[model samples]
Target: MELITNLPVLAAILATFLLAGLVKGVIGLGLPTIAMGLLGMVIAPAEAAALLVLPSLVTNIWQLMDGPKLGPLLRRLAPMQVAVAVGTLLGLWAGLLPGKGGATAGLGAALLAYAAFGLLPLRLPQVPPRAEAWAGPLVGLLTGLVTAATGVFVLPAVPYLQALGLERDRLVQALGISFTVSTLGLAAGLASGGGFGGGALGGSVLALLPALAGMALGGRLRGLVSASTFRRCFFLGLLILGAHLLWQGLH
Candidate 1:
């Protein structure tokens, strides 16, 4: 729309989507994390988030559709479902807070930092039952908060999942399900907060094309890339994005 018609901004959005899609296609996750980071630089964090919702839905839906072995996926993640939901709600509430520009940037910075550290591939020993009990709620809370604030919920969970050595299929399924649930929650929360007006909603729809194009290309190129390579690219991209965010915030 007119809001994003600036040639430079349009190019940046498309380029962000193209790279984000490729990352997701090859690695099973990273669409929001990458796209939001780049787009956030070009626009408000909320606008970046608005831009991401449809694409996140589209890409995750595609992932959920193709993913098999649902039973195992559910079983492995069952313990945390409630936590995810709860965390998502909390995040929604957080999003509704006033003076959100600073909060959104702060949340984005935290997410970027988490993703950056996760690049080191840290792992905890077999998690204790009590830890597992608490982990879900904590991660869910952070995920939801991130969703509400910046339209991204990959933090903490994405890295934790990777650390757990999840197979590609399970990783994709888990993220897809999580994103779907949380995004719906976010949509509801944003609607309640009077966040998605006519122009923003229109922009959100327009943003979906780049997201879809990115994911489609990623899907096609999936076989050509190694997981580690993709992960490295994702992590490094986050590092750059995170630094950029911090610089933007400081200035």
Candidate 2:
């Protein structure tokens, strides 16, 4: 594949990363989600994920470094993270199936689903702790499958987290930790498959620099927006992106 490193494409990539980072900075968990949603239209899902990996990791590091102090919050969410990681592997396996388009379709569907749910008045029922165990496996599988294309996995968990009444800080922290593991897992899976090298990977890594810069800038501006306003605007953006992806995939 020919890499587009021309000045205009480079500028576009930087702008996209900045938008993604700004969204994440404002919302606490949308850097890759926003970036991949937008970028997947222009690049392969795997490539999009690869590009966002570094930025997601770098941004989340600060979020998670402070997470250790939130003991109860960490304890409650750790299991879900474990489940997402496990499910991601299964998703990857399914993704690798020849011509199945499991990863690509699943990623797009998950994003659409997440965006739609976010826009609606959706809530999850509280299950007993034992039943809660099942959520991890399901989410993991979904995360893995979706990661193959868009490199974003937390969509499956969004509703659950929103319903859990988690404060913004805890939710963001949990997401950061979840993505940290997801990114590492994806790297390992790609390595084993001998994927994501050559110009594509280099381009992705280079793209990550601008993404991080954008996120940093956005994080700085996050305080200016009211929570409710941000929430509304965020969902609207997701809705638009989701519809666009669905159209792209179906056609």
Q: Tens-digit lDDT track for model 2 on 124-201?
A: 775456665666556655665556545775666666665556676776777777777777767666655656566656
The whole-model lDDT of each prediction reads 0.69, 0.67
- TM-score result, candidate 1: 0.84
Report the C-alpha lDDT of model 1 over 93-174, residue by residue, as the tens digit: 6554312656545655865676667587566554555566667667766666666666666766665555455676777788
**Reference-based lDDT, residue 35, model 2:** 75
Window of ten residues with lowest summed lDDT in model 1 = 95-104
Which residue pairs does candidate 1 place in steric collision? 21-214, 87-140, 87-141, 91-144, 91-145
